[model samples]
Target chain A: MKVFVTVGSMLPFDRLVCAMDAWAKEHSEAEVFAQVGETSLCPANMEYSAMISPSEYRDHFAACDVVVSHVGMGTIITASEFCKPLVMLPRRAELKELTNNHQFETAKWLEGRPGIRIIYSDGELAEAISKSIGSDGGSIVETGTRGKLINTLRQFISN
Target chain B: MKKILAVASAGGHWTEMMLLKEIFDGHDVAFVCTMEMYRSEVAPNRFYAIPGVSRLYKRSIAVSVAKLLFILVREKPDVVITTGSAPGLLAIFFSKMLGARTVWIDSIASIEQLSLSGRMAKKFADLWITQWPHLADPVDGPTYQGSVL
Candidate 1:
């Protein structure tokens, strides 16, 4: 299995990266790559970099079977675009991992969505990863709403 | 062709703006984002990178605002649009001061409610939008047209 982990460009999510790295250490069957941002924590078991170009990010996202990351909307949208199962761990405000608790709110709203799993604790990371290995990925269907939005904006701009 | 300033902070806001790339077709478009590296994504199109700030980063907000004002003056776009966070909100505010039309698309990630920035953008945005239809209200608005996601 190929796993791509991202913590976003703005902040470091050491908790998520550490959990995934621990899991990677025990699982020789999986190839794990991470975009860890500018963090002090280095993953001993996974290939990681501070950041990757947007195109390179897309390339890794397209090639991955599963994605593991924080409750970032970019990651969520990209995972859906590529039909990849996603395992999300939200950053806590109290932990000072993020500016606020918006991620927790996103996680709450995303609960029970198909092919997406949200785990509050890193303890469940292994189980989530194990369960997602062979599962069929999920995709966001392009809806007519998108076209209408484009048209609305296009018309508004032209006028 | 109208000059359009497309602004978004990095991460989801930038992602959402990219997904709406079609809106920029045939228009004179310039992009503003938080991450300098994203210049490649909108290559050949004019791109500007500004310092990203949030409410928590109170100190940096002034610096970001100054940069945004400079861009707005230089571009003098006909319209400014963003899938927002703090920086986008600032762009919308400054764009309006410059007599430019502004659109604010609340991030899809704000499924529970409009983001803090999105909520504040309501007053400044000439056309406010929300991805979730349920969040739209005729009285206050954040009209639901469709989602970029």
Candidate 2:
């Protein structure tokens, strides 16, 4: 199985990257690739880069069976669009991983959503990954909502 | 075709704006985002990158405001829209001052309440929207049209 891990473009999420790398080391059967994003820690067992082009990011998202990420909306939305199961860990404000605790709020709000799993600590990453494999991912995108939003914008722009 | 200036900060905000790409079809759409590399994603259309600012980064706010004002005066777009954070809020404020119609779609990540920037946007935007239906109200806007995600 192929797994893709991303820490997002703005901040370095060493906690998530290091945990996944440790998991990768133990799970030789799984192929792992990561977009590490300027983190000081390097993953010895997984393929990694500091950043990738937007198209490359999409290509990785499309190719992977599961996505590992911080609880960022971009990752969540993209994973939903691709129907890929997502395993997320929220960045803690006290840890200085992000400017605020909004990620925690997002995680709480997304608690029971299908095809997505939220793990609070790095220690839980491995089990979450295991649970996510071979599962059909959930979608947050609603076609009716998209249509209504588009129609409203079209009318407002034209008016 | 109307000239539309679409602004978003990087990451989730940019993703939301791109998902609404279909709305800009056949119109003249220009994009302003935080990351320089994002220019590749919306090529052939005019694109601008500015230093991103947040409540934590109060120092950069002046630079962003000046840059957004410059873009607004130069583009003179007929309409401006953002799926936002701070930069988009600034864009909406400047665009309104420039006599362009403005729309602000709050980021879906702001699930509990409107984002600080989204709240500020309600004052300046011609149309303010929230992705979550529960956040929408008839008296207090950030009306829910629907979500991009």
**Which candidate gets the maximum TM-score versus the true structure?**
1
Tens-digit lDDT track for model 1 on A1-159?
899999998778898888889999998788999999989997999999999988889999888888999999888888887888889999998988987788998898878878888999999999988788778668743455788889999988998
Clashes by residue pair, model 2:
none
Tens digit per residue, CA lDDT, model 2, B37-59? 89989999999999888856789
How many Å off is the CA of A36 in candidate 2?
Answer: 2.2
lDDT of 1 at A75: 87
Off by over 4 Å in 2: A140-143
Q: After aligning candidate 1 to the native by TM-score, how far in Å is the CA of B122 from where it should be?
A: 1.6
Docking class of 2: medium
Candidate 2 per-residue C-alpha lDDT over A1-159 given as tens digits, one digit per residue, 9 for 90 to 100: 999999887778998888888999999988999999877887899999998878889999999989999999999888888899999999998988887788999999778889989999999888889899999887854546888999999999999
Name the lDDT of candidate 2: 0.90
Best by DockQ: 2
> Which residue pairs in candidate 1 collide?
none
Q: How well is candidate 1 docked (DockQ)?
A: 0.69
RMSD in angstroms, all models? 1.6, 1.8
Q: What's the CA error at residue A129 for candidate 1, in Å?
A: 0.6
